[model samples]
Target chain A: MSVKLTDDVGAALVAAIVARSPYRRALTPMIGEITRIALANNQIRAALADVAIRSNFEATRTLGRRDLGPQRATLMSFLEYVYFASPAFLASVGEGPKEGSHNGH
Target chain B: MAIEADHCDVAIVGTGAGGGIIAHRLAKAGLKVVSLEQGGRLPDDYFSETAPPGAKLDFGIGPSTVWPADPHDSLFVHPLFADGAHGATPRPADGFRHFQILKLNGLQNLWNGVSVRFCEADFAGWPFGYDHLADDYSQVERLITVCGTKEGIAELPDGEFIPPKPLRPADTMIVNAVKSLREPFSHAIPNRKAIITTPGLANSCISTGICTSGCPVGAVYKFSARLLPEIAGLDNYELRTNAKVTRVLREPGAETVSGVEYIDTKTGERRRLEARFVVLAAGAIETPRILFNSADDADPAGLANRTDRVGQGLQDNPKSVLSTSLLKLWGHKRTYDIGYGDLLILMSRGKLPDGSDFPFIGHAIHGLPDVPHYLSGFAGFPPAVKIRMARMMFHSYVTLGLFCAGEARPENRIRPGSTTDSDGVPQVTIDFTTPPAAREQMASMLKWGRKILRKASATKIYESIDNNGTGIHYAGTTAISDDPSAGVVDRDLRCHGLDNLYVCDGGVIPNLPDKHLTLSIMALSNRLGRHLEERVQSETKVAA
Candidate 1:
């Protein structure tokens, strides 16, 4: 979590999540897909908790073979969303997301 | 051997928004003013020959930008320090925090051309009241020739204007959405921007659309360009380009500043220039760097650093950017240039999830132009998806960039580096820690930015997960206070113990909200000019 300014990969990943507005739009639909897939497959839901989110995104290409529907690209979007927009980041800042924190500045 | 000294009535350093306005006011008062700038002055036609952003960087200080100023250097630098190379200081001891320095001369032209005023509530920790600053704001408005419509918002006060840029198709949709929303669903209005529409003192904005790169014509108001012509005409004023000031000299026994020492960048000659007074307007980071580097036997810790607050209280609005398309504008498929002031301003207070009021957030919504056609050719996209992505480019996507008012903490600061710069002056390292209050604001802006975009019929909304503080509205550091223990500068913006020294920049601002700070810095500099005028006349009378 002690990311320095020079860490290009970390910075790019974070910027892709926050500054890129449509990416959050990438979230709502993807999360819905995640919910639907998790309800049907016990193994995928378990992997979300046990396997690292990065590893899960890589694992998604093979998710195409599963009976659970969604184009491979849509599945990739879901994995990317879960990896970047995770609630775990608030832990680094030492606070959970406060309600109504998105008020005007 | 004695160093040669050229004496002046007043000496000013730096020529950004703060220094330029001070020079304008003082020179107009007929006092002899000598101004020094580290970067070479851009010729009036510089933008015409070179692209606006690169004209100066080809020869001088480069901005890794505070905004989308050029296609080459597109994204705003994460912390405003991304491009540092020559004698660049290492990261600070507390490197994880927020801090960066963007001191480019005439760089204000690259801003969103915003002209916002801080409200009465935003000045809570300040020694003075909003009423006192109200008049100065008016004075600065007229000087800069700001143009905007008055909405009568208390937090975002009305200002002197020449009529704001009319809303584009996308902005109109957002405004219509705001009108339909529930009570204070964060209202939207045209931004009070420094860009002029009708010609008078400065040339009017021609709506050429590519302003952030530096206006090729005389439209956007950069303090350097606006006042340089008049200041040049003044017989008592002189502006020296490429003069890198290293330190403010204090006599071995004296409490006041004796003069300034600088190097002539062109000639590499070291020189001393003495004056009755010196103003450190190099900006918050460099201003403190100068003070800290002036550590001689007479003042070991640093000049005017008795309170240990010289480089403390560093700040910038905790910023967030979200992208979305306009509902009606996208249906129309209209092309936009984004050549006007901020399309809309968002202002409101929110009650947080933690059962407490969140720190205020203000947003400036600028219409994004067409997605660069070149992006359509990226080979990485699937051939089938390329067609869809190209069609999506027609959407009138807008970026709602939010700036949050954060409380200053002692841990947020910039300090002199272990080594010297190319000019032989110490470079600086920045460190910042968002206090709990400011952290609350960070959360507030992100949450609200997403909601507002969604309500406005936004599609493909991307909320920044890490991007914060690309805006250069920095403040604090040599903060003003009536009590020395509370800050480094006094109520009048004078250095606490150094009688002949003063600081006029964002550095003296004790409290900063998300409001744009350039106009306010200009107002404060004007006030400082009048104070110095009075003091000079009194001294003249005593001498007579």
Candidate 2:
């Protein structure tokens, strides 16, 4: 089954993945750019084929979270790459916590 | 068309750690130095974080297009390993793919900033000992601003260091575990790195954790960022990028080199640059390749192959990685304070087959940018679960990267390939097999690594052992020795029979140490620079 990486699909996929993250609010603005680039990758495009089988948005979201073997790992790697590359995500984590917070005691 | 270039006091082939430092040192001393770099200069904003996405993105955390993807590229040097019976095969390991970085600053641009000095025992077969290069080491440390603490360990000698970034919770846990070990295993210190830690520095490390991809900030030590600017203003120094050196040209019937022949990569024109002294700092692989390709009627074997040792005794430290999840720090907030990679250095000693004490070192790495990438590799986890795990368990993760010493075997060598490259230089064929002792030592190191992780109460542990040459710390092709019969270069790094040709790269390292080789290479280059400065002065005085 071939699924075209359209804007709607890319946005839905990126949104579902970002929703799983604790920093979703911070990472929300980056989804559009991340989706544009992530969809260009053949691995991500191929992984979206599994998502196209489901009819509803909730089904697509659940399928993205479910096990798809190596594809799942591929999706996760792309997600992490997006997070690291995101300016918002970097700004949030770049300074780290204040000096007195949790020094492994 | 063949073009005659200007003559200089020294013609250094390569602008990496060795060539960059030597050029700086000589040019600073008022000697005319010309450095030939095969790769062109990268843009000033090449490593900038806000740089536009395609090539910059590939350079940072993606499959590096920064390194030549094809062997046919001018910057690429083909490396082949020996098959069973005289045949060769492309090396299967991906780690070796990063070996050749033919850029203006060479491999230093992609280095991880792990700066470690060779200890007293690491100088076993060399003509000089560690003490001989101690001041040189200190000079390099100060120039690069290495960060760490003085642990006073004999095997892992302390160096001049600035304050290192404070250890994260995961690092502290691992350090305590290593400290709890038995004799010969209790030594652990902050990992010394060539990085700018001084606050308010122009581009200080902000703990981006994406160092190896190339530091966006100029915090990590890179010759392009650190040394190039220093030498650029010198009247005596000239840097010619897109200059691919072919071979050192020795005058007929003379033992000294006359000049060098190279291809101007931009114009595709062959040119000759005459110099009083020729230095090959190309790299361990490319340096030997150039020497072997210089074979002619006078030397027959090669210019420096009077002892047939130009491409012999190649060695690279074998490495093993142990990934652990500290149970106590699970679900803790992930901190972005990775100031370059490894946070702590764990040193220990093990017994060889002959019962001799062997030194081994392990680096504790946490909060690297690729933590999530590693987490994604865990089996049975969905994409969402893995992402959540990465966010939650990032603070708990620690990878112990251990390295064991490699032996300098004559059979393990790099020779010119049957075919020539695009620039007409012979392609490099690296024929090396990991010694059984190295494998055994790696196994032992992994065992010790596991023990430390278990002691730290790691909830899960994973082990991965890389093949030889994966360490990328290649050395010992043009080995140094006092006796002319055994080695290619002598005590002063001058080619055995060739008076004016010298090698100042990792090629002169007689054996591979457990520590990284960049610092030692830089120190040797520093020593060679001082030596040449004195030699030139003395020669000028005698002539006068």
Candidate 3:
């Protein structure tokens, strides 16, 4: 069964996969393919997103520590790593790369 | 797809300030350009200047506010230093010790981003006048976002600069003191730094003050951050990392260089690349070494070493450091040492009491926290009092050194060494000695600095015990001259006999002036790029 996935669901799926699996290098491409397939079939065209995760990056890029100390700095770094790959974020949820199915390095 | 072009419009060696700028200019002009970088791209995380091994954080409880570890073996992410070579000469003197090269990031990876331009008499002996370099200097300054004030001082030519950084409490005191002096021994002009004090949110400097650790925020104007993004995305430009150019190819009885040969540093594969023009920006030492290594069986002295002067006349400025207090100027007002170092260096032309001037000295006011250093300087105090004094005095400190332009003697040269790196590239050794004049000038400059700091408002003084952060401004291995006999390249930096081969880097700087070498190198490279573009256009029209 083809499951209709919204952005919220797709982001959640990505966050879950990245957080649970330490090897994003190995799995991001598969995630990207799953996202591409879901989005192209008009199955995951929802406007909704995981609001908390979206703001996490925007705030982290500005380094709004929220008093979390040094670890927040580390978090900001991780989020920035994801932010630079935001195109990959779209590719994973929207379409796989034209050159390849996986966008993970 | 890999760059499948058999011949590009231009081939450049190394990607430091010189090569990066020239490559950007050439590629932007719609020419296919290939850059041969000896080092690979550093992973994104390596750009973070705040990480461990890259940086440190201690509150004096456990780690005790330690200093950043010197990037030992952390050679330039791109550099001109010859690998697998031995230091054949022993430098026992405190000021002149060893000639070293930093590979990997080149000089920019570890650079502190001090950018200064050469003034009138600074170019006294050159073939071209200052007007030729003036506009290029201004263009590069704006491109890099240099912050400083342009002064009327003739020997110290000023250019278009961003608003100078605000002075720290100590800087204000020193400036006020210098201004109040009867003869005005030195001027406290705002430092010309390649750092962005103000920028778009992405690359702004937060003034973390550990800039030499590397500017993690991209505020410090490194070549990769400033020039690479623009060039790398261009359709006509190609950056081939892990490829070390072994030699420039020229057919028998050919007047122009045809192509180049390089080795893949990682895969150990030999590759040949072709281009209409080959520009060597491999830096002062390595550019010469590449020419020396490019020796064909017919021309055994290397490609452009036809005049036998390819690797001759090596030079570097000798530097010294002195620490002083701005306490007399630091009254009841509270001050913090959190300014970015590359943002806050102040420059003064080193002049003796007799009115003779030496190379200039650019000094930085840092918020360093090394108790042991200050303890040694303030040895007269008791241990506990020494710590307190060190802390109090260190609060308002300025460490500065002079730029004594050393001579480029033929004896001070670079020659192929017997040893070879893993890539089978033969190592090159530099034979240099601090000239007697330079040595005397250094002592005089140091002595003058001591007298001024004492007069200006200094308590305890400390100096660099050895030649540590000196000679990174190495140059003149391939001096540019109108007389082919004296230089390896001509006025336009073209190899004397070859039409298409060029050398732009510190290698083309015939004389070492007391300026941050990057600004001049960039200006020259930009000038060469424009010149090459015009030349190529004219040639195309003639052929058409």
Candidate 4:
């Protein structure tokens, strides 16, 4: 989950994520549990939010804003689909296979 | 320190699709443009040498991609992988995943030269749509001279394209079968390619099959040889090769960019380039890397990283290649020259129950001339069956090979981080697993591809189980963002918070449905160039 760049909640989230706040690790298990609960209740968006939060926490710790500094906008666009729009994405197009079998980049 | 004048109105990084177009447009508009290229400024003469894929790796940044010494830092160094040493292999991270993952370290290996356009349904909810960039696409096509016929699909864009290469006999046979099935399949033609048969060059390349080895003649629309010099002669442009830009120096709070820090590769000398604006076109992987490296204590999160979304949400085109063998026909020996391959493009979409379209897009079929011959040897039958295979061939039996490249949904993403490499420079760690939906699509396409080949009475079919990474076309991590949380850059290629800094590369693509991202990157840069021109003009008018 990317910290929404446009909102205060997002800005705070970005700060925490980029800073790798201690609170972030605590939210992971919490988000996992919430994701399960949300899925049981069919609240996909909520589940996705929890996942986003967890991802944001993780992203902040490793990549931080520095790595993505110039490309924050592009990275966020990718997250929108990852955190929120992925399910719908898979529904329409049949997921295809990876192009090459074993070469790594 | 020498106070040399190294200043320009705009500085563009890279010289491929993005930098090339930006230079072309900015120089044409009479702006002082300084384009920096990391590669050597080789004329047409240097490009005439033809080597194998691994041998010619030096033309680009990396060394000869020999096995074990994977000179290109693009692919991860691991045991049992290419390691830049051996033939390709299948390295699927998960067994049950739906889609096939091609194992090229980058996009270059997977591309079959099928050019495609994004569908309106593809960009349905995004900030912009296909029509918005139509004119820009036209500009890109003209600059690059794309080739293909416009299939009247509302979702796909058509343009002034070159005529596609003809289909080989083997491909024609498969096309007949697909058409006979009437599955609404349209054969793909290479959309926007660089190869042109020019008259005046001293060395004339006959369009041999070694496009991967770099075009021998000056026929291809390569960045260094073809586009850069043309853009440089515009008088408004000055190109600086072997100059590595290290940072986008900015003032304290606002997005106003002031200058750049770079190291001249030739002299190992560091210098500051003053510029009103900076555009980063350093491919996908390096673009984000530069951003992260540019971050300092004041910006700890990195220069434009207030949102912390910089290196997340990376993606790659979901790709698959199914190689099958054709039983031999009595009088046939298999051998195909570079240009004799049959190439066709595929474009059609499937709809969901809710009427919204899916992202499983298109594929192009190429290299049929080699497939039939290659397959006859791999029919997977015993030597005793040779007579039987021969008998089958008299009835027009032949080997068939087919590879399919499909689109990856947004969920399949990659991030830029490093692992402990033998060398300290972070080894790119890409964590991508094929999604189920895309897997189902590729499987279906394989079935369809096989079905088409079978129509020609192909006696032996072997879906290739061994292959490595697709070379050099990784994109979609740093895309144009509408919401700061969802993207890394704005629609105009600028970082959300930074006013004068921009990224124009494959990394800025929001989607990588097909591996044909070079064209779009070129188009986006062309658009960026136009925008820069307008800004410069506005500033000039105000000064007057």
Q: Provide per-model DockQ scores.
A: 0.02, 0.09, 0.01, 0.01
List candidate 4 stretches off by more than 4 Å.
A1-105, B1-5, B41-47, B50-113, B185-192, B197-205, B325-342, B348-429, B464-471
Per residue, candidate 2 scores C-alpha lDDT tens digits across B261-373 of 98887789989999999999998888887887788888777778877888798888877788777888776665445555577888887666677767788788775333133
Best by TM-score: 2
DockQ for model 3? 0.01
Residues A5-73, candidate 1: write the lDDT tens digits: 222332233323222323445444444433443323333333333322332333332222232222233
* A65-100 per-residue lDDT for model 3 (tens digits): 232333333322222223222344323223222321
Q: What TM-score quantifies how close candidate 3 is to the native fold?
A: 0.75
In terms of lDDT, the poorest run of 10 residues in model 1 chain A is A96-105
Worst 10 residues of 3 chain B by lDDT: B57-66
Worst 10 residues of 2 chain B by lDDT: B66-75
| Per-residue lDDT over B1-544 for candidate 4, one digit per residue giving the tens place of the 0 to 100 score | 1123578888887666577678777777778888776434443443333222221212111222121121122123211123311111122354211121112112222223344566565564357887887788787776665556766756566776866544454555655655676655444344345445233454233444334434445445655545655665665678777666666787656568787777676677877888888998876655665676577666775666777666555554444444343433334432332241224554444343445443334333332121113323423454336334433342233222222333334544443343422212232334555555555555554555566566656654545321123424556657787787777889888888787888998777775554366667777888788888888788889999
Ordering by TM-score? 2, 1, 3, 4
Top-DockQ structure, candidate number: 2
